[model samples]
Target: MSERLTLPIGPQHPLLKEPIHFRFTLDGETIVDADIRMGYNHRGIEKAAEERTYIQDLYMIERICGICSHTHATNFVQAVEKILNVEVPPRAKFLRTVVGELERIHSHLLWLGVAGHEIGFDTLFMVSWRDREIVMDLLEIITGNRVNYGMNTFGGVRKDMNQEEIDETLKGIKILEERTLYYEKVAREESTFIARVSGVGYLPKDIAIAYCAVGPTARGSGVNYDVRRDFPYAAYDQIPFQVITSERGDVLGRTLVRVGEIFESVKIIKYALKNLPEGPITARVPRKVPQGEATSRYEAPRGECIHYVRANGSEKPDRVKVRAPTMANLMSIRHCLLNQQVADIPIIIAAIDPCLSCTDRLILLKQAGEKEGEILTWEELRRRSIAKKPL
Candidate 1:
């Protein structure tokens, strides 16, 4: 009989599973069971929002995830605006959508490059990221930043689009479209790429739906629901696009969904630029928000990012809760890792395109009745929960 052993992947600079600890029970490289733990990088962003005013929280929420910063800011602004009953300017809505799609393109390309590096395909990684710089440059031209565009605000956006910027954005999208076509060909025809991802980490449709997985993770598993399509935020109601999905439900399927989303984003950006309206970008907003609670959702690059805000009759918010896409996808991700060989584990986890920074973390305590304990990081504490040997 094969001996069962535990394998740990940690930030000890070993397996490089940053911000999350994974312990797998393996029988000769065949994973028999797995344990996923959180609480490594929790910053209490949600609790912090309660202390800040509505205006201050906008930027704070934007910092939730660097890759999907705009999505976070937009959704937070939308939730607050709903409480204030403010009608965002038509042009502002369109502009916010443009930046959102641009961020999506940049994020998906980043994921593709990272996925390539995970499987030892550095050439594809280099080429994909090289093309991603075009989108980054365009974002910088419009919003003056690469990572965190800082465009979203309560009631509207901070920056206004001009003719030159619109023309430049269209040109950049064209280049990305052409490059996407080539990458699509490679993904379809490349022998080694197909072999590695195909059938690896198969997440069935039932598991995806049951776990409430959102974004590409849910879509890739044949679940046909997209927040942009169903919920319709920003200018999504005005703009037209299709949700990409696959029945394969494997790592390859999610990759295809993200690639297809890039093309769709290109289309949305072109449509928004062509139909760009002229008007004031920022709307007049009141200092004090009314007492109420609301939820805002956005189709972020990873998946569905939701923000819940509860405002009292004051400048500061009473409560603000955020649920990131990676948190939603983790359950299904664990299921995907099961029954698979250890060698394929890295790519399989990377398949969800996990943003552990967004997953954040929480406190874990171990004690007897009527006792509570503080949380600890790996560096702070070791040899924990040591049971007292039977006396």
Candidate 2:
């Protein structure tokens, strides 16, 4: 009988860029069990949202995930706009769709680079990131910022695409489409790349469905679901694109799905830019949201990002909740890790493209017989961190 050994990775480790802990129990070189622990970087963004006005909340929400800033902000406004009963202008809707798809391209390219680095394919990493800058530059041309575009508002978008910007964007998209095709070819034909990830981190379709995984993590396992097509938002109903999926249920499968998505995003952006409607960019909306509750779902670059808001006839929301895609996809990580070799851990985890910052949350526990849990103030939380206090 082989002796079982336990291996711990992160909260802080060379393998992880974020603060997440994972313990893997191994029998020889093969993993037997895996456990995940989060909460290392909780910022209490949801609780803070309740105290701020709608406009203020939008700014903070945009910062939730630097990579998915527009995703968070767009979803937040969509929920609040539902309660306010205002329809976004057709032109603004198309503009939002354009920015959203550009962000998708940026995110998938970033993931491809990271995945390449994880498997020691630094050349692929470099070229994918080089092409990624093209999208980043296009985002800056349209919204004046690369990371957080701040393009979304309550009734409409904040900026309109001028003729010069539109021409620049179409030109950039042409370059990106050609570059992504090259990546697809590499991911499909590179012998070493395929050998490294082809059979690693297998997550069957049934297990993925049972674990409620989302994004490429689920699609890679043959689950035909995508929020954009399943529940259209912004200009998606008018935009024509296909949901990419794979039946391989492994790291290589996820790579194929993301590459396919980049092509689809390029298609969506081209269609939106060519068919932009002529209308006002912003619609007048009331300062306060009506008393009601609503939810918004956006197909972020990672997966489905959901935002919930409840209002009580005030400038501030009564409650705010967010369900980031990482939270849903993280559930399947342990399953993927089991029975895999230790050397394959990084690429397997990277396959999900997790943003731990968006997944972590503050959890307040109550003692026995206590009906309510104590809430910690910002000052108290800061002080505890400075003093190295344990939760």
Candidate 3:
């Protein structure tokens, strides 16, 4: 038997893009076991929502993920609106879908570029990011912001996408579609890229399911689950697009899945623009929410992001719990990293494109010096939040 030694890859490491820490037990170059710690930057947005008004919480949620800001913002509001039984208009639905899909494209391109960079394929990284500017410009034009579009509001979208904007967006989509096709070819045919990624991070189908992986991570492993197609949020049901998947269950497979999904996103964007209807973009919403709790699910670029909001007939929510896709996908990354080479760590972790920001939360708490800090579950936390007391 080989003696193994433990190594830390985070808290601060080259492999870590965020502040997540990973402890790996390795036998020589191969990882034998792995554990991850995610709370380094815990911001407690869920608990913070209780202290802020419903409108204020929307902005807080949108900041959860810069890449998938639309997803977080939309899902949070969808849950609030559900508690109020407010239905989103068809036009607003399509507009949200347009921005949402555009976000997906931008996110995937960013991931692809980062992945290429991780594998030392800087040429591919440079090209992918250069093309990503098309989507960035389009998002700015549509939402008046680049990173956090702030398109989503309480009942609908804030941005009223005009005909000129639609035309320009369509043109941008066409350009991205062609670029994706080229990337898809390069990802598959380029020997250098394949040599670095193929079979490097393998997550079998059963293992992926057992880990509760979501989004591209699970889809890459042949798990057929996508919140956009399954739950049908934001005119997704009206849009016609296939759920892109891969059977390879490796880093390369996830890459291909994301690239393919971009093409699908383009199709949805074009269709939504062609069929856009005339109506008010947002509905009037009440300031004080009725007492209710609802869960919202949206397929973000990374995976399914869920928001559970509980209102107590007040301006603020009693509890706003978020389950980002990266939380579920984190387990799969541990499994994928096991038995892999130490050098493969960064690329394997990057394959999931883990958003460590969404994994943590911002808590509303007073400083505890000699005072004992008690760990509270979501239920207990909800109680304190409802009472407007500090933990």
Error of 2 at 272 (Å): 0.4
Q: Please report the TM-score between candidate 2 and the true structure.
A: 0.92
lDDT (C-alpha, whole model) for all candidates? 0.88, 0.92, 0.90
Error of 3 at 319 (Å): 0.3
The window of 10 residues in a row where model 1 has the poorest summed lDDT is 382-391
Ranking by TM-score: 2, 3, 1
lDDT of 3 by residue, 167-202 (tens): 999999999998899999988898988888999899
Index of the highest-lDDT prediction: 2
Q: Between 2 and 3, whose lDDT is larger?
A: 2
lDDT of 1 by residue, 1-391 (tens): 9899999877443444466888999999899888888777777788778888887888877887788889889989999999999999999999999999999999999989988999999998999999999999999999999988889888899989888998899999999999999888877888899999999999999999898898998898999989999999888898889899988899899989999999999999999888887888888998779999999998999999888999889889998888999999998887898899999988888889888778883333343585666668875454354535532
| Model 3: lowest-lDDT 10 consecutive positions | 361-370
Question: What is the alpha-carbon lDDT of model 1 when measured against the actual structure?
Answer: 0.88
* Residue 50 local lDDT, model 2: 87
The per-candidate count of clashes, in order, stands at 0, 0, 6
Candidate 2 C-alpha lDDT tens digits along 164-212: 9999999999999999889999889989999999989999999999999
Q: Of the pair 1 and 2, which is ahead by lDDT?
A: 2
